[model samples]
Every structure is written in C-alpha cells, then in structure tokens.
Target: MTDLLRLDHVTKLFPVGGFFSRRSMKAVDDVNFALSADKPEIFAIVGESGSGKSTLAKMMLGNEVPSSGQLSFDGTDVAAIRGRAAREAFMAKVQPVFQNPFEAFNPLTKLDEYLFATAHRFLGASNRGAREAAADAALQRVGLSLSEVRGRYSHELSGGQLQRIAVARALIPNPKLIVADEPVSMVDASLRMSIVNLFRELRDELKVSIIYITHDLATAYYISDRVIIMQKGKVIESGDARTVLEHPTQPYSIALKGAVLPPDPAAASAIIRQRQVVAG
Candidate 1:
C-alpha cells in the first residue's frame, strides 16, 4: 500500500526584510518523511519555538503551501486540491486540532453546536436525530457524553474538557490523519497527561495516524512511536522515539534530553546543581 502522507524534499520560504528586499528565509528546509497507511502510529515533530514545527503542521493541514517539493496525501497532491468540493473531500480525510482550545471555539457558542455542525457537514447527518447520534458517538470516544457538553459554552468548561471536545470534533470525520499542534501546552499541569494519553488511545483504538507537534520532550517520550527533532527549521535527528531520546548522539539532541528534569527529587536537584555550577 502507498503511504498515507508523504513530504518529499518539502521546503517553505518566507520573504524577509523590507518590502523591497528580495531575501527569503526557509521555514522548512528539504524535509522528507512518510506515514504508512497500513499502520497507525504517533509521529512526533519535536522542536523549540521558531523551529518550523508549526509551519510544517500548517503545510500538512493544507493551510500553507511549500515553496519547493511536493506534499501528497493518500496518493494525491495537496497543492493541487482546489475548489470547494475538493477541499471538503480532503478535509474529511485529514483534520486538525489547534494549539489553544480557548481560541478554537467562541465563548458564546454552545459546545455541541460545533460537534453537531461537524457531523452534519461531514457525515451527512442531515436530521437532528442523526446529527445528535453522530456527535454523541464522537464525544464518547473522548470520554465525553452529549449531555455533558450539549449546552455548555467554552468558558463553562475547563481547558482539558474543551481540548477533548476539539479532539472529539476532529474525530467526527473519521479522518485518516490528525495534525495536532501543541495540543496540551495550554492545559493545566494536572490534566496534561489526560490529553497526552488520549492521543495514544486515538492511535491504538481508532487506528488514526497523528502528527504530534510539541516542545515538551517528556510528553513526546511518553507517547510517540517515532520522533523527528528539528532545529532552525531542519530535522537534525529521526528514529524510534525511545532510541533517539534515550541515547541521542547529536549535541543539540543530547542538550534537549538533558533539559528534562528527572522525576526523582535527588536526581533533579543534582542536575540543577550541576547546571548552577556550570553557570558560575
């Protein structure tokens, strides 16, 4: 079988300097990777701020186009997908869960409205009963029920609940791939694991391939099957998540791993003291 998604020598450039200036900066530089349609796994794109991870997510979601190379999904070129019908068809197969759940929905809108609308649009759940059933099923997959969110507003729920709703909304389409960018970054510390663990369930049970974009190496270690570490818009390392993160050879990769604080108090304290000594 062909790959579900393929980015072959993909590159994106942005014009820099003044309006008259011709210089350009590469946001994504010749990145190549593929996800198998036969297997579903959590593929992590790890990087710090301005590392072009978000830019890559945008390109995968069709929100932005690459300046060079090709992006294909399920054997068709993403850049060539034009027109309202084609776009909607593409959206049904690929969905996106954005970074901030607070900004993803409107405070005035009822939560179920979003889910119901998704069902109606993508699932062809034209009747109220059909839409409600479709929405309820998707909500259940994320550990939510229709009664829990039917009339609630964004402000009425915790960040974790709202983010789960966002994931549930993405699921209503039964997408082949989900591109989630910094999903748990805005949630509370107590609830971060809930969202991270939910992604694992999404892959294992639903067989949905996910491109998880995050700066949190700890959570990436906990959930990802494979990881690609990016720096200055380039992939410096790629391999099995455990192998690359636990025994990274590159200086930058090692530094990133060292940045994670150990769970044990004494070990963490010693690491902090070592850093303090280095600074002195």
Candidate 2:
C-alpha cells in the first residue's frame, strides 16, 4: 500500500522577542510519519502542552510552513500547493476538525451554513437543492440529520452535537484524511465516547485516515492503531497503541500513562505501583 501522506524530518520554528535579540522557538523538531492510503486507521499523536502536536497539524494542513524538511500528500510537495485552486484541491482531500467545536463554527451564523458552504465550495454542488442534499448526506455520516442541525446557533447545541456537526462539515468534502486536534476534550464525559466511537466508524466504514491529536491517553488507547508520544517538540515514544501504552519505554510516555485518572481507587493504586516500577 502506498502512503497517502508523508512527513519527512519536518520542523517548524518561530522567532520571539526583539529584532536584534530574537530567539527561535522550535515548535516541531524533525518529526516523521507516514499514513497508508490502503490502510485506513486512526493514527494518534499524544503529547502534553507545548509539545508541537498542534504545530505539526497546522504544518500538515499547509496553514503553516515548515522551517525545514518536507510534507507531501500523494507524492506532491505540500509547501508548493499555493493559490486558491491548488489549496482547494488540497483541502478537498484533507480537512480539519479543530479543538473547539464552538469556535469552529460562527456563533452569529447558522450551523448549516458551514456545511452548505463546504458542499458548494469544495464539492462543487451547484444550486440550493444540490448543496442541501450534500449537506444532509454529510450530516447522516456523522450520525446526525439536517432537520436537527439546520439553522441552529453554536450555543444551542450540546458540545457533542457541535463536535459531530463539525465532523459532518469536514466530511462534506469527502476528505481522505482528517486532522482532529483534541476533538472531544471539551465535551461532557458521556458524550466523549460517542465522538470517539464516531472516529472508529469513520475509519472502518468511510475508509478515512484520521490524525487524532490528543492528550487523553484512555480514549487514545481505545481508538488508535498506532501512536506517537511527543515532548518539547520531539517524538519521545511511538509504536502500536496498546503495546506502547502498556509498556512505555520513555520516561515521558510513562509519566503520561501514569497521569491517566482511573475510575476506581483500586485501579488507581495498581496504576501507581506500575508507574513506580516503570519509573525505577
């Protein structure tokens, strides 16, 4: 199976402070990964704050350029994709589900607008009827209906609903790859599973590869096939999901696995002892 997307030694840096005394902040440090088109799987990027997971995502989306290295989609250089047509072509194949569902849509506008816009703009659906049909079809894919979501404000919908709608909008273009950044973090506990499960369905049913960026290890463990642990703009640990989480080789990975809050005190105690052993 050929790779759909590839990141080769990618790095991104930002300048800070005064002009003369400017300091460079390395957001992404020589990270590398590949997603196979034939293998539709959830690839998890797990990391704490300031770990460059988000930066790497932005670079992947072509929202930010890499300071060094390359990002290619289907063998074409992502950095070279410029202008409206080129970007639209790239966007049709790769879409994003932002961290906050509330912010992803406009508060003042109707939720359906984003979906309809994506249909018209990306899917080339002409006229109101065609656009509406495409929008409704997308909604159905995310376990939602147009009637339920049409003309609704961002505040009116629950976190889970909003996230699902966001997912639906991203699906409007029938993207091959979806970059979701901490998608379910803001949703209520009960709703978190629903959204997480949807990602599994998207991979299995829709054949879409997802780049799931999250700090939550429990859900990551549940949904992911392959996982990468990042720390301070570098990949410290990565491998098959369960194996890496069960027996982490890196201290950062162990710490992250330790930080997961268990449901019961007994389970918590067991995890603590395990963490102690791993730390030793």
Candidate 3:
C-alpha cells in the first residue's frame, strides 16, 4: 500500500485586494489526506459551496499550485513536476471529471472524437483501429459504447450519457486516481444514483481510486469508503464514511446528518406533514 497522494499542511491562498492592497484569502487551509496506490477506494470530500473542496480538487489536479506545504503524488512533489512530458505523465495517472458534462464537451465536436483523442493522447493508441478499440473498451466499462456515441454531438445525448462519456474518457487513460468534482450535480435526479454508483464500479472493477467532491451527503454516504467534511476551507471531521456520517461528532456534521432526507417515502411524507403542522 504505497502512498498515492500526500498533503503535508497544504494551503492555498488567492489574492483578494488590488495589487496595492496585497490582501490574500485562504482557499484551502492546512489540509492533509492520503490514498494508497494499491487499495483503491471512493474518498468523498463533502461540503457546501465556498467550503473550498473544489479548490482542493483543483490543487490536486495541478491546475492550481499551493501557497505553502507539500503536495505530492506517488512520492513526487506535484508543484515540482516540470516539463510537458512530466506533466503529461502525471495527467495519465490522474484525471478529472467536472461538475457539468456539457461544459466539459464541445457542442460542435463529435462525441467519439473526444474518446478517441483521449485514447491517443494518454494511451498512445496512434492508429485508428487501436484508438477505436481503446475508446470502445473504455466506454463499455461505463455502460456505454462507441457505436452509441459516435458522430453524435454533446446536445444529442442526455446529461447522464454525457457524464458517462466523460467518465469513459477519464478511464481511457487507465488512471489510478480520478478527481471528480461534483460529477453528478448537473445530472438529472433519476440518473444521479447511476453516476454515483458508477464510481463504486470503477473502484471495484477498474481498481481506480476516486476523489468524489460534492455537497450531497446522501450520495456521499452511499458511495464513499472514507470521507472528509470541509467547512470554510478547513476539515471539520474525517473518518470512515459510515462511522462519521452516521455518528457525527462535530456540530456541523450532526446538523448535516439531520438534513438528510429519509429513504422511505412514507417516512419522508410523515416528516413533511410534521413540518407542515409546525408551520401551521
């Protein structure tokens, strides 16, 4: 179980005021967590908007550099990764699935092109035959296929389908760690679980570790093996998903748990009725 990622007192600060003022704000403050290379699991970064979970995700993706502390991947410093080849190598192992699938894809470009391009870029599938094979195989893992997506535009597919294709593109790289920042937020309610469940399949079948960043506690509790609750750029609670979410010790965590809707419709209706009576 080698260290896949390590963050030693990591912090990210952004300039707030004008150049004259020189004021700065902390986006991610003293955060630390590690995922093992061999033991892949779904790790959720749970928080609301402005909690800095997305910033943390960006830092992990190397799109943003930390202001202080060490951010390492596989024992190498992420900020120190210099040159296109080194960065490309790092990208091959770590991929990103953004919140909105439509925004991630080009409306004009054919869907298959994105898949084939990823296969070519990361997996080095130069020839059309090899590229198509790699693309189709990756798509199949996400319950989609090249035939379904080929020659289709982003607008042609449903949000769920586009998101699945996004996952497949990430999979084409054979990545060890995927930083999916609110991957299912833009998807429809009925399809949300399918996308959430896909992460479990990815961890179990493909052995890919996931960094699932989202504000949805229900989905987090459903999928995550481990979780870290973030509040105002700082971690409030961190532990096993079941233990922490079910038996939350922190005040905020407890409040969050109370907000989760009941699974049973009858029970949910009862709560709603109770709330209505209280309001009345």
Candidate 4:
C-alpha cells in the first residue's frame, strides 16, 4: 500500500525566555508515523495536554511548519507548498476537524454558508446551484441535509450537530486524510460516542484515513485501529489498539490504562465508595 503520510525525523521547537536566556522548548522531537493511502484506517494519537499532540496535528494540516526533518503527504513535501495553487491542492486532499465546533464556524454567518463556500472553493462549483447541490450531498453523508442546516445560526444547533456540519464541510473537499484534534471533547457525553462512531464509518464506508487525536483512552480504544501513546512529546507505546490497551508495555501506558474509568456504573460506584472510605 502506498503511504498517505510520512514523517521522517520530524521535530518542532519554539524559542522561550529572553534572547539572552538561550533556551527553547521542543514540542515534537523526531516523531514518525505513516498512514497508508490504499488502506483507510483510524490511526489515533493519544496524549495529555502539552504533549505536542495538537502541534503534530497542526503540522499535518499544514498550519504549522516543522523545525527539522521531512513531512510528506502523498510524496510531496508539505513545507514546500507555498503558492496559493499548491496550498489549495494540498488542502483539497488533507482537511481538519478542529477541537471545538462552536469556535470552528462564525456565529453571525449561517452554518450552511461554510458548507457551500467549501464546495465552491474546493469542488470548483462556480455557480450557486452547483454549490448548493454539492453542499447538500456532503451534508447528507453526515446524516444532515441542507434543509436542516441551512439558514441556521451556530447557537441554534447542538454541539454534535455543529461538529457533524464541520465534518461535512471537510468532506466537500473529498479529502483523503482528516486530522481531527480532539473533535468531540466539548461535545456532550451522550453525543460523544455518536461522533466517534461516525469516524469509524468514515474510515470503513467512505475510505478516509483519519489522524484521530485525543486524551480519552476509552474513545480511542473503541474507535481506533492503531494507537500511539504520547508522553511529554514522545511516543511511549505504539501498536494495534486491542493489543496495546489490553497489554500495555510502557509504564506510562499502564498508568493511563489504570486511569480509565469503567463504563459500568456499579464498578464506578464501587471505586468511588472505596475512595470515600479511604478519605475518612
């Protein structure tokens, strides 16, 4: 299978302190991973805050440039794509679903405008009718339609619905890879699984490779095909989701696994009761 993305000895550093201090912070250091173009899979990046998870996502999305090494998508260097034409071409194949759905879109503009705009921009639909059709079709893929979403303000929709619209906008580009950085963190718990399950559907049915980044292990274990655990900007454990989570090899991975709360209320309650007893 051809590799969709390849990171060769990639590193990103940000200067810190005054000019005289001579110190810098390394966000991502020599990190490497590859996604297959031929085989669509949910490849997850798991880490706590400040682990450079979001930075890695940003680099993959072409929002941030790496300090060293190569980041190639479909054999093209991301850093070299400078012109408007090249950047647009790269954006067509790689899209992003940001962390907060509310913040992703404009409050004043109708949500459907973003969808139609994406279709017009990326799909080359010049006229309003063609753009509308393309927008409706993309929304349909996410179980929403133009009728439901059109002319609606951002506040009118729930977090889950807003996120679905964001995904739909990303799809308008017919992207092969989506870098989702904590896509469901602000969403309600009841709706969280629905969105997570949607990512699985996008991989299996739509054949889109996903770079799913999150701090939640339960959701990661549930949706991901492959998983990489990151700690302080370094990969601690990497393997198939079932194998790694069930039998974690690294100390940090073990600790992360131990921290996961069981879904069953009885088990959770039992643990809570034990904690209460200890506190007394």
Give me the overall lDDT of model 4.
Answer: 0.91
> Which regions of candidate 1 are displaced past 4 Å?
none
Instruction: Give the top-scoring candidate (TM-score).
Output: 1
In candidate 4 the C-alpha lDDT for residue 156 amounts to 99
Candidate 4 lDDT tens digits, 1-280: 3889999888999898997997888898889888888899999999999999999999998989999999999999999998998999999999999899999988999998998889878989999999999999988888899999989999999999999999999999999999999999999988988889899889998999999999999888899999999988788789899899989999999878866779889887876787688799
Residue-level lDDT of model 1, residues 25-107, one tens digit each, is 99999999999999999999999998999999999989999999999999988999999989998999899998999999998
Best by lDDT: 1
All candidates: TM-score: 0.97, 0.94, 0.94, 0.95
Q: lDDT per prediction? A: 0.94, 0.92, 0.92, 0.91
lDDT of 1 at 151: 90
Off by over 4 Å in 3: 263-280
TM-score for predicted model 4 compared with the true structure? 0.95
**Which pairs clash in the backbone of model 2?**
none
Q: Residue 265's C-alpha lDDT in candidate 2?
A: 97
- Compared with the true structure, model 3 gives a TM-score of 0.94
Please give the RMSD of candidate 2 to the true structure: 2.6
**Model 3 lDDT tens row, 116-224:** 8888898888999999999999999999988898899999999999999999999998999999999999999999889998999999988999999999998898999
Runs in model 2 lying further than 4 Å from the true structure: 269-280
**Model 1 TM-score, 2 decimals:** 0.97
- Minimum summed lDDT over a 10-residue window in model 1 is located at 255-264
User: How does residue 128 of candidate 3 score in lDDT?
Assistant: 98
